[model samples]
Target chain A: MHILLVEDDLQLGSAIQRALERLAYTVTWLRDGQSAIAGLADGSADLVLLDLGLPRRDGLEVLREARRQKVATPVIVMTARDSVEARVSGLDAGADDYLVKPFHLDELAARIRSVTRRHHGVAANRLEVGTISMDLATAEVSYRGERLELTRREFALLQALMERAGHIVRREALENSIYGLDTVVGRGALEVLMHSLRRKLGADAVQTVRGFGYMMPREPA
Target chain B: MHILLVEDDLQLGSAIQRALERLAYTVTWLRDGQSAIAGLADGSADLVLLDLGLPRRDGLEVLREARRQKVATPVIVMTARDSVEARVSGLDAGADDYLVKPFHLDELAARIRSVTRRHHGVAANRLEVGTISMDLATAEVSYRGERLELTRREFALLQALMERAGHIVRREALENSIYGLDTVVGRGALEVLMHSLRRKLGADAVQTVRGFGYMMPREPA
Candidate 1:
């Protein structure tokens, strides 16, 4: 996912940019509110981490103007304003979520999860297919009673399939999700990864639909 | 939704362009494959309608190049070649759907709906909350077995709410969905439209969450 981070604090901004990059998210960090407004209106941001305090303009004003102009990108306000009135005003001004500063990276990740899940029109952080559960908050997967250990590529593959849950997910879509657009991946790399994944679970965990894609049954057979 | 149209036939291209615009879809119409490739790579189109017979480049070549470059936009191939092999090849080259020539406008609309639904990581075209059912193919809504009367804005609003059924869809998000990002809408227009929709569906159909937005129950109250 691509994130637009708006913060002028060098220390906190660098920390967040680094953390998000570590999580494999593409981050574009801007140090002022004017750029933040333009970024939000440009229609590329999957989500925005906005700060209420900024150098050029107020963050609330940026958000308000964006919303008034019908920019619908999900925004999580990360700021030091912890008052109840401030949070209420933030939400009223079209922030999708409000996060007080001095927070842990884990909490930030979890909030990103919840906000994005809702942004995708799913109500909760959990995506379930049969006995396999994907916890978006922790980025964890468990099958039956055991935690399913997966590599980053495997996790991306699983996420792509499980997001659709019970359908034949297109192979091209899976490749784009796992390897990302513009990433050079070798031929048969996906098959090799799928082999390892199926071996980790069972052969029936994901079924290949010949010439089409792959499907995971809503119920494991 | 924004559509990228690639077709060389002036008659068919003009008809489709007009029809899509009438349906409220923004279309960037291209007369050949080279521009289609560039348009697909630009990432603005939500969907692409590609004609297999093109001027400068073969449609399959365009599709193949775009897919090779990892452009993941959903595309429906419109072609006069109706052979099973041609259809299979189109799908293999990453076309999301195939439409043979002499297709009705209704059929084209249905294909667009299905392709877009799957592109959004959803397997089905039906969104049901409570007794209200929204049919993507027909763009129709039925509440309690009775057809609901909705204007375009009202339909857009209902579709937005029903897409995120059972959750409090933010007011700003709803406004963006009902009115396009570049549209100029008056303040309280959403409220006025929502009131009329509720009047038609029933007062209890949608409930407001104060200081937040609106929620429609999974089961009607």
Candidate 2:
């Protein structure tokens, strides 16, 4: 998951970024609300962890402006105020969830899951797309109710596509999803993974845009 | 899943809310950071959809405040602006994933799933508690990885218990999880389902928590 963390304290931001990254999440950190607003405008973050105290523009102003412009992403408000009025006011103003200062990261993670689950509905452990389903725990995929055996590389490739299915995934993004930011894969590996997936899931399951990337088409109605 | 959506534009907010509900997600829409923060403080919403723009509180200030107080619920920022600087800034401030506006709701759904997966580390589609693994899709229970057939109601009851293995699940929560809010179930039904689950899984699979609900023990490590 890609996350935008808006925190001004360098130490706190770095710590949270590192922790989230260690859990395999891609994190982008900003030090102020102006940048946070700018980032919200740009569009790529799956979620926002908004800090109220920010330089340049206040976090609340950024949120207000974002909503005025019809940005519909979810935001969790974080602050030092533990008063009931503050909480009530924050929720009233469009913050999704409110957390007082000095809470546990694990609890934070739990809240994140809860909010995401609420947003997506049915927060299950597996991802089901059409006839294909991927189990995050086992990293296994089953197509048409039958398990389709996949190699490590092939599975990783499919997983990336499945994660971002329906969108016209950029070639570079696909490569990065499977090979990581620092690693370079050999030529034809993506093609090979696609070939294997097609052979297993029937040729029409995945669509290649050529020069762009791939998209796992949704099942016909 | 309980979601708090903080978008100010009434038309867009209502539209997105309807769309999300159509996808079966339970959502509460707020117009500003103050309300958003209040919802989170109450611990009602599981995840938040935050807009960077608002009337009073901006998205970044909300996030900064929430973070300062240590609210850990996940936030996804959505906006119409597109800029690398905005992306960097939002990430720096504490947004999970930034998504630009004018995006397909389907893509937003996938992004929600992606963020949830990253935040929660993926829950098992089939939960294994003690010797039983409950398959949520098929509503089948497996003992020692061997399939154990069960009736629909029995399967539902077992699914609820296994979801929060190692923790006591209140009777009301279990009832709501299995039976809809409008539906009424008999006390005997719960007992019968428990009997069937125990018969299939094991005698010790579920333990009755007096006056509260039931507890499903975790698998021995």
Candidate 3:
């Protein structure tokens, strides 16, 4: 999971960032709402954690503008104020959930999990592809109840491929999804990852697209 | 991430569920808007892939009702009807991004990444905490400008910690993020992953929370 954390307090921001990452979430940190808006325009976050007290733009205004521009990303508001009216206003402004200061990190993670679940319309935590079944929260991949050991890169690659099964993923995009944006990786890194994935997933699980990309055709039941 | 896939077509739903799993996203397949709404109300998904041609309730109507109920999960609309009117109406009625049928799985993945990025209000692909940095698109992690080599599980665990940075994550959640929800991992799985993570990350990089979980403290400049 990826999260956009918008807050001005350096301490809290660092704290929340660490907490979220430990749970395997990718986080993009922004010190103010304007930066948050700019990040939204760039289009990469899975969820937003917004603090109302910010420099340049207030969290609520950013929320309103994002909705106005038709950015339908989920937003969760964080603030020191816990008034019912504030909560109501935040929700009315399109914030997904609200968190007050001095809140529990567990609660925040739970809320985030709930919001993403609702956003994606997932009713359960397990996902299956062909003969392989993946438990989302546990990161386990199994075929016919037998487990396969996958390297982290292999697992991430598999996850990426599974997310788009039956459709081709361009080499560059696939690379981006696995390595992320800041690291400059080699051209052959994806191929290497794919090779490992293929070995673990069994032959014919993934198909190469020659110069285009790769695809995992839906398995015949 | 968990996804609620709301498509009336059983074949398509099953196929998509497979595809999404390959990408490592957990999916719960629902056949109509009513079930989708129920799933959302139950708050189980990380995001929603909603088909506008849903039975029981229209996709747009579901969206309106979700918003009315202050359900803030992000919704990505999918449809066979690729008309401008459909796209506009979907967005206007509260759907996030609209994907036309026959779209590539890679494109869907990209759209999911894009909307997820937008929703989070952060740059979509990078993970930064204190002096440490990791990029999801490029597969690199650095601390104090020095590159760090991490095993896949270590990298994932570190990425999770970096995402939430200062928060204390519970052991169960940490295990879920690393191993997933359905994999029946042994008691020492987390300890092994954490030990390897600390070894690669250098001494004092990650802190043990004793009974709670682990934490990645911010490094000084």
**Best prediction by DockQ:** 2
Question: Whose lDDT is higher: candidate 1's or candidate 3's?
Answer: 1
Query: Candidate 2 — what's its lDDT?
Result: 0.70
| CA lDDT, candidate 2, residue A199 | 88
Scored by TM-score, the top model is: 3
> Which lDDT tens digits does candidate 1 get at residues A100-214?
9889999899889889888888665777888888776666789886898877677777877777766666676676556532254675998999999898879999977654467
Q: Calculate candidate 2's fnat.
A: 0.07
Model 2's TM-score against the true structure: 0.41
Ranking by TM-score: 3, 1, 2
What lDDT is reached at residue A142 by model 2?
94
Error of 1 at B180 (Å): 26
What is the lDDT, from 0 to 100, of the residue A41 in candidate 3?
A: 48
- Candidate 2 lDDT, B84-144, residue by residue in tens: 5565555556676777776655446656765665555563445677667664422445788
Candidate lDDT scores, in order, read 0.78, 0.70, 0.74
Worst 10 residues of 3 chain B by lDDT: B175-184
**TM-score of model 2's chain A:** 0.69
TM-score of each: 0.44, 0.41, 0.46
Identify the candidate with maximal lDDT: 1
